[model samples]
Target chain A: MISRLKEKGAGDLLKCIQCGSCTSSCIVNAVNEYFNPRRIIGSIVKFNRLPDQDPWLCSSCSICVERCPQRVNPLSVIMALRMIKYENGDAPPSRVFELIEQIKKTGLAFPLSNEAYEKRRSLGLPELEMDEESLKEVKKILSEAGF
Target chain B: MSMTLYLGCLIRTLYPEVEKAVYEVLGRIGVVFEEPKGASCCAPLGLFSLSKNAWLRLNERNMRLFQSTVLTVCDDCFASLSDAFKILSEKNNVRVPEVKPFGKFMLEKLEEKGLRFSFKGLRCAVQHSCHLLRPARNVDNAENPMVVKNVLEKLGYIPVSYVSELDCCGGLVFEEKMRDAIARRKAEALEKSGADCVVTTCSHCMRQLKSVSRLPVLHLAQLSALSMGANPEEIGISEILLRRMVNP
Candidate 1:
């Protein structure tokens, strides 16, 4: 896992001195004390494995990145961890699949609703439409990415 | 130069008022823009985290539509789109357009047109999205970190200083229980600031903050639209919004 993370661009994992500043400054930690960034870093550096749900708990705001004295960029490390998980056939929550499915179908995160159409029409702004070709291309990209 | 507007999923589906307000306000300031097709979600936090390639190619495909600038109200989208572009362009040699968020982009145009408006002394708590302010390199150069605060002040409004004003709204994490707690905690701090309305730039933050706070939430475009000659009622802003919320 250490070699994989290094290859996956989380080489900053080596730079961490485990100062615990990240866990202290983390906003998520303020609410759930168990969601400690320090523990994640320590565990990942030591065992190269993340505790259950640790990486996903991060909001990816990069506050820890800005606060890290070692410039470790823990958020990127978390992201790399997530990608590693997915590559190993571990899936995220169901909503992530739903989002990709929505994008595949509508080329959007959500389906455009009637109220939106009414709002746009009422405003007299020209309707914005995604052509079929564009939708096809979007699907192609998602498919190529193995979504 | 005119901008090519990229209405991501949230703005197009949820907050058309923000869309309308931004379009009308930009028109009022003499900037030409087009609502382009072929745009999709920037795969935000969850999607990006789970699959970086999907996030990269989807955004790159979307970027294939425009050159120079793609204007948006979603800072998360701007952050994701720009980061994807930087990664793809550097690694895979793919090209992508630039993303300009609402606050800094609006301030630039207002400066160019020499258009200034006052806020009539309304006090607002500006919610800064983490994506906009952090990982700062590769951002759209929104100028100072206080771009929205400066714009509010220029429009004659006061920004209330409060603890945790710069904290994330915690919208990125997918854990439902922890997500709600984070949102509620941040909202409590914001409400305690005693600001009139919670003002923010990102549509995602507006929704998340509004769900958790009793205070009225608004996009910076909504507040500035009222000041930029768009009718408050026409753009879905209450006519009493400013007068009722002004700081004592």
Candidate 2:
């Protein structure tokens, strides 16, 4: 677990000293009693398992990281946890995979649908345009990165 | 002198009006902004947490897609592209084009144009989105962005200070459970500031602020246009915000 977390991005999470600053700054914990950052850190440190899908609930806003005294980067801890989940054959939501596919296919988040085209035209903005070379390069990078 | 506008997926997909305002205001202020067509999502949400390597590579691709200065209307894109620039330069030893938020870009250009804010008595608290000011190396003024405050002050609006003004709006999490909590904090900021409305430089913040705060929220571009005496109808700001514009 330590090796996996280190490989992802939250290697510094081992520096966590049970400080509750992350909990105090966590927007999720502020709302839900079940979502506790301190407890999750303890679980990862003491045990080898991610508590649950709780890490996926993190907003990736990095507020806790901002407020963390040790600069332990609880946000990365969450991300590392999610990466572990993905590696264990637990795929992320299909919507996320769909977005990844969209980028590879069209070099866009979503196609400039007719509604958007009309909106841009109404605003006198030009239509979406991209060079073929950039698209091919993006595909190459994603393919090489094994994304 | 000119920059390619990097309208990320959020603004293009969900908030095209904000994109419209960005173009109109930037154009009005003498900015030669062009839409970069091939730039995809600035490493779309969850991509970074999914794979940091992929996120940086994707954002680098998007950043390199445009050869000129890149201006972003979405705070997430600003952070993502800025992160790409930082990683590519510092970590990977590669250089890419400049990616700046529309607020900072406009602040510089507006100062050059010597434009003054026309409205004199409006009060607004700016929502500083997390991504706009995170990761330390993404921007020079990540600690506290003065762009929005300066624009409001020049426009004759009060830049209010409220509790947790710098807190995250929790928009990045995509968690429905935190909506009420996010709304409460926004209400606290608005109530403390005693402002007529909230303003933000990020499209995501603008959307979240609107959902949470009872007061109307303005994108800096919309506010800039309104302050410069542009018609609200043409800029595509909501009627609620248009109503709050004093002496427009």
Candidate 3:
């Protein structure tokens, strides 16, 4: 388990001292019982395995990092574990997928109609246009980026 | 010069006027924008916990759409794209294209892609997105709240101070009841801060802040637009109101 985490550059998990600082600082646990950084770390250290779905409760907010006295970045640890799950085809729900679909169908993500553009121009803003040449350039850039 | 502008889901759906304001403002500053076809969301919503492969793939695809450069006016978009770019570039051992925190990524990507465009120095306040500040370690002084101040100072904006500038607006957890109290506390503190206008990088933060405060909330792009002489009305502040009447 340590090796797996280290593979993601989070070898610093060994630095944890079972301190309850992170657990006490966690906002999620304060509101919800599902999240406890101290318990998560204990599980990782003792059993070398994280609950398959329990870690998803984290908001990924770095409050724990800011409050930790041991300088252990528990958020990164959680992220590294989540990344492993994602690679294994266990990604959680994402609003981004729907958003991407919206962008594909519409040149602009927001519904910017011709009338809206005209209104903007009437307000003295320049016209926004998209041509085939510009589209081709955009596609090329995404391809190179491995998109 | 010409660059692809990344408008994230929130701005595109909830506050599109801000997007228009960004274009109008940047245009006055001599920044030419192209609405790239086939552009997609930067996928910030699931970024922190999404599968690395999916997140990186989506972001790389999103970044690839711009020919010369990419301009992300939304702070969430900037933070999401920047994180993905950093991770993918390092994992794949490729040259990471520079992503400008303000709008310079537009110039750099365009130049790298061999697209021609010209731009002038822009003076603007860059509000740091909370996600970028809180979760991400790349930002400086998240606790004291100075990432946007530094960016604006670097880009030449007179930085302003708000008492609760560093406090969370409770955006990420707004669905939680506790968020209301947290946001109100943050809002009152920030309102007392002496900024002429509040400039933020995150659409969520912008919405959350604007919902509770009477002070004008400007996206970094909106502030940039104001500096470039775009009318504040064009950004649709009046249309953005929630219509909740406070009983005196």
Candidate 4:
């Protein structure tokens, strides 16, 4: 699991000193105590165990990334954990899935509504049209990424 | 004096007004910019959790379109593109263009002068987007970012100090109740500060703050355009905000 996390770009997570700075600065932890970065990293560093908590709860604000004295980017570790869980059949939230599907089809996560299109036209902004080639390329990348 | 503007999905889709503001402000400041044709999304943070390779590849595709410099209004897009640029440059020797966030880019341009401001005395609260300052690489003082505040100050607006100024807006949180709870907390802090309006660099922070805050929220570009005498209507400045924020 540690090796996988390193492969997923969280190589420095082992440097976590359990200083709790990450948890102290965590915005999500302030609102919800269950999402503790220190505890999560401690478990991973000590036992090489994946966190029992939902890694998606991390808002990716990266305050933890800034406050970590050991230079362990807790946000990246959390993201790495999320990728491992997701690739192993754990589903992300439905809204997240919907965003992926939207990107797959339109090459955009937030496609404009008709009202929005009218608004854009009224604003005199140029129409943002994605060419077929770009869309095909994006879809190819998404599939290759296992989305 | 010129750059390519990458309008991330949020500003391009949900809040086209911000796009207008970007155009108005950049034009007023003599910074010529063009939106890249067939530009895709910036590959949102969720994509990183799925596959970092895909995220980098997609962002690299977008990065290839811009020749010299790329300016982004959304902090998420700014962070992702900056990260991809760093990693790809180190690994594959890709020649990624410089990525500048809207606030920092505007600060640099407006500091050069020639633009005039028509509004003053409006108390504003600035939300420095987390991604722009964090992982401690994008900026030096991530703990107390003043990029947005400095830009507002340059334009004659009073950036009021407030508690929870450094708190996250929880814009990326997947849970609704938690997201709103965090936004609400920030809203209360802003309200207590007696700020007439909120100014932010990121569209995600703007969207999240607007959802819960009673005070008017404006992207830094929108506020700058209005201050520099752009037509309020054309820049999508609401009559209420214009009266409260500009005329006050």
Candidate of highest DockQ? 4
Between prediction 1 and prediction 4, the one with superior TM-score is: 4
Q: For each candidate, report its DockQ versus the true two-chain complex.
A: 0.70, 0.51, 0.22, 0.83
Query: What's the TM-score of each model vs. the native?
Result: 0.93, 0.87, 0.67, 0.96
Candidate 1 interface RMSD (Å): 2.0
What's the CA RMSD for each of the models? 2.5, 2.9, 8.1, 1.6
Give the TM-score, chain B only, in order for the candidates. Answer: 0.91, 0.89, 0.72, 0.94
Candidate of highest lDDT: 4
Clash pairs, candidate 3, are A138-B65, A141-B64, A142-B64, B25-B225, B68-B109, B68-B110, B69-B110, B75-B201, B162-B193
Candidate 3 lDDT, A1-147, residue by residue in tens: 777876764537777888888777665666555668877877888778765435556655577777677777887777677667766667444543433344444433344556656665566543344455544543443345333
Candidate 3 vs. true structure, TM-score: 0.67
lDDT of 1 at B66: 73
Error of 3 at B45 (Å): 4.2
Instruction: Please give, for residues B1-248, the per-residue lDDT of candidate 2 as tens digits.
Output: 77787877756765666777776677676767567676777774667767788888777666655778888888788887876787788976766778788777766777877877666467888888778776564453655767678867876788988877777776665556575576567667676788877888777677676777787777777777776667677666567655665665
lDDT of each: 0.78, 0.73, 0.59, 0.84
lDDT per residue as tens, model 1, A11-115 = 477788999888888889988888887787788787766656557778887888888889998887787887888887787778778888988898788777888
Clash count list over all predictions: 3, 3, 9, 0
TM-score of chain B of 1: 0.91
Model 4 / residue A94 / CA error / Å? 1.6
* CAPRI-style quality class for the chain A–B interface of candidate 4: high
Q: What lDDT tens digits, residue by residue, belong to model 3 across residues B1-248?
A: 57666666677556657777776755655667676545555655444354355556667766666565556666667777888888888888866655555534433333454442222233222335666666545555566666565444533355665444555566655244555655566666666665445667778778777878666677766544544455657766433221211110
The whole-model C-alpha lDDT of candidate 2 against the native structure comes to 0.73
lDDT by residue for model 1 (B27-79), tens? 78777877667677788877777666777777777777776688878888878
